[model samples]
Target: MRLCGGHSGLLLLLLLLLTSEFPPGWSELFGWRDKKVLNVECETTGYEIVGDDFLVLCPGHCVGQQPLVWGSGVYASISSVCGAAIHSGVLSDSNGGMVRVSKKAGMRGYVSKFANGLRSISLPKWSRSFVFPEASRSMAESSQQWEQESIVSTGDKVDGRRLSFEAYRKGFLSSEAKPAAKDVSSPKGPNPFQQYIGRNLGTASRKPMTTTVSPKKMNKDCNVDIAFLIEGSWSLGVRRFESQKRFVTKVVEELQKTTDGAAVGLIQFGHETKTEISLNKFPTLQGVTLAMRKVSPIGGTSNAGRAIDEVAESFFQKSAGNRREAPNAAVLLLDGWPNDDLEVPARVARETGINIFIVMVEGATSEELASGVHGDFVNKSVCRPNGHFSLHTDRWTASSALVSPLVSRICNTERLICSKTCLNSADIVFVVDGSSSVGLENFPALLEFVANVTGHFEIARAGTHIGIVQYTYEQRTEVELGRHTTPEGVREAVRRVHYWSGGTSTGAAITYTRREMFAHSRSGKRRLLVLITDGRSYDDVREPAAAARKEGIILYAVGIAWAIKDELDAVANDPKSEHVFFVSDFNDLKTVGPKLVENICKEYNALPRN
Candidate 1:
């Protein structure tokens, strides 16, 4: 009853063909059809690694079903994880082996690229990825050879005949392998696939990926003063109006749960704008939600421009519970085009250090959204060119989906505040009067004030640069512009400034800063000088202040106890109220610090970008 040897071999081959677990091309070429298949071992380091069969290399809570892999120096979605490893030079296609993928910080900017036979689609910024361990020399050589041979011209078949392992081994043993010829006449650089290969092979330097601040981290770090501007006009029926209220309530709830320092207020705009909730009215989540539920729609014409103006003039005032230290943001939810012009009011709102985010509901056009933005729609003034601040939905029913993304945008303080003003692109010099009048007890307070103001800026050579000048008869440059390129470095340098008390020569300090500290100021960057004094200067400051202003330097005068008002007026720039600040005591400097920063941002925003 036993079958012949040939028949038995044929039966075994058929079984292997039907029960193969390896990918299509691999089983046929490598005779691995009957080999024992092993489940991928996903090792965990504190964070849980999800996906039982396919491992997700990225860190953080893996929210969705898709598995992310590190390919071509970026986080990409590939059809096959093992194939991507081979294409990324982490494994060899000839004989695939175990790969060790470690998680790292999320990065900004991902691009689509091709490698070997695999195609990778880019993931969004702040999306997590993994770090693949270096492959063995033999494996690397095989992967490199396979990559060079697999790349084909546009329109060519990618799944051509697979090369034998012996042939690949022989090619690896050779000194070098030539790649497929590309058309020399083409103007475009090598295809994305080639570039991807070059980056992995070390032929080209890898571009440093910018680390993105996670949403959770951003929520804790950013303090936002947000006002919700709702359009409750006749065009938006009661149902849609209710939907808008629900959306806003949900957003506030999310913010309350996640954000560290957040204040919420609402204004309903129709024929007239009504303040439903002041920024300081409800300090807790329960109160805000209760107030939101009680809001009744005001049926009339939509005067969006007036509502925006109200936000700029009244909603964000200190009386309204607007924190001077927090960045100002306004979320405008509109159902249709406004009857009044939006350009002038929006411009004024932006000029007042308010970042405007517009969400156009059904019946509103993208053109109106563009018009309502702070700058030209193409080049946004506040946020990045990526349209995170503006949103439009074709139907009101879909409004629920906008809450998470909107909350994320509001919490992203780096993009929300720093990108809007001169916080990221100016040179700020602090001139302190370290005289005998300012006793040793007050010196630390003065330094603390300087550090607090410095915290508002992103210290970088290409971004905002900070300088310090401590004057007591003679001026000393404690920190020079561009001396420190990081916030920590600048803060540390400020802490190290030694206090030396002598005579007060405010005029000489201003002149010294202008001559020594600002001599090397970069062109196309805003120049700002902040002068802090406790009393009147022994020497004249009017001429030096005037000279500083003449050279296009913006001056701010901060006077502590016993300081002369006349001197502050003479030292400050035009519109003295905006540029001059007075505090009764040295400890009150903390209260004035934010106001000074807000004013500086306003002045910086008013200047035309170079």
Candidate 2:
């Protein structure tokens, strides 16, 4: 009918002849066989979730809305199905019979009677299908080549002519749009100042997990990403590597335990540089773990720098808002010195703005390296790097797993989880009894107590500052004022604190805190002193109470079993009663930790009482 209005049989026959050269269902026939895409076709409308059969969707006769169906975890909507997400349901609408409702991606389903039961199944962002076989083949071949050579993946317009498909009961043909040919010159990716490296610690569960939906990105300025570059060198030995591998595995498993939206990547560098088993290779958690298995610590050169380079290039592409991000900070786990050129890595660190951290296993020192080795390379990265994967996950276990060093950093400021530290910038110090009554057996518990409480803060926006001072007959400060602005330092200091055995000098410590801490305190600052002691002080506490009250220094006393209630009351800010706590014993110190910190933070809940 083009240019000529009269319908001609010869013209129609010619058009059909041309179209026949490109079969409509050709792609459907070869898609799965050729590994073009996970070819999925539903003889019944709705999704046939992976690992699920008979998951069908058809309209319900209900007067309210369309009916739903559940096969696996996915649900579907099959009312007047145009294009909307589906849900689950029981036997809904009377089908045009039990004939069967069928479906294929990109194409709608047919309800024997109704002509319009067509809808597009929502595919995961990471999951995709081809519109054409030849075009798909071309694109996939290009993508696969890029992948094989460790090249940055790319996409383009695929030719539909070569990918024509005729969707059927089992499969469909798709004409892939021709992809615009591009000359992709593989550039040497920026070296990582901060790298994310981890070995396949253990088998992570690939079972479908409920993924948390990310909030809509407001704009570019506020974006953050991070990755871990793990060292899988032979030097790690089987024993060390095995443990480290386990650590990395758990780190990944637990990452989703907290927040699924926290962008993360994993890189393993040893004798050879490979990241196929890493976060960089796949966008989905399942892809990541699948790749993780193919990985072995083969060809052993401790190329920590090479791993860093790959992470920097592969994951931390353009920065926060460019596309997907690399880690905002990178942690490098190495059993030994870097064998790659340090200057190349240093230059990359400078360019990528990645915060780099170097965690040397077996206590390898910076001095052990050749002359140019600089901790400053990773330390000075703009991304603020902290490296190490503690295979010692059992040191502290809760609902999730994480490397202690990395956990400490993540619990701090920048990305998310800043409420704990950013909401209030109060100055609070932990005063430990450290008397003979507190033995070394119970010391770790105290440190754990502080960690439990203080770790709640993310330490953002000059938010919260926590200090530690332990005293007996004599008082000594564990974490000095202004030592760590971030939560990592505070956690580290608390973990490394030295406990002393001596007489309780509660009064002397109180007096010292009031004079040295409060008297010299900055105006508008909320000074809080939390004292952990077993009982009354040797010296009179009345004087210190008056000074603290006068100075508005909120004093909270946590008594462990033998605590003196009357003396504790006097040390309180007001009726002295409100600030005082009576804990059952040191063993149960964790019970009272959150309460004490909450009380202090409550005051700053408004405008951050400083």
Cα lDDT of model 1 by residue, 1-610, tens digit = 2446768545443343343223344445543232222222111111122221222122221111112233355443222345445547665444445444444444644543444333333333322344555543353244343323322111111111221222233342332223323323223421111111100111112111112334654444335768899988876788888999998998877776553547778999988889999877764655787888888879887887778767755576544566534567889887767766565556545644577788877764577555554334322423333587788788878987898888888877655543344466678899998999999999999999999888767565445889999999999999988899777899999999989899999999999999998887877577899999999899999999999999988899999998999999999998999999999999999887767776776565465431
Off by over 4 Å in 1: 1-219, 364-386, 417-496, 499-610
User: Candidate 1: worst 10 consecutive residues by lDDT?
Assistant: 195-204
Q: Give candidate 2's total backbone clashes.
A: 62
Error of 2 at 274 (Å): 42
TM-score of 2: 0.34
- Candidate 2 residue-wise lDDT, 1-610, digit = tens: 2435565434543432344321233324433221122111121112211111111122233212221111112222221121121212112232211111223232222111111221122211111111111112233333332222211111111111222222221122233423322312212443232221111011122222233434352111212345667767766666666555565566554444443333456677776676544333455444454555555666576777676666544454322121211125556665656666544553454333345555545533555456355645444432323232122222222213335445555534333221122123467778888888878887777788878777654342234567788888888888775567666677788888987989888888988877765554444356788888886688888887777768778788888877788888877766454578887677788777655654554444333210
lDDT comparing candidate 2 with the true structure: 0.46
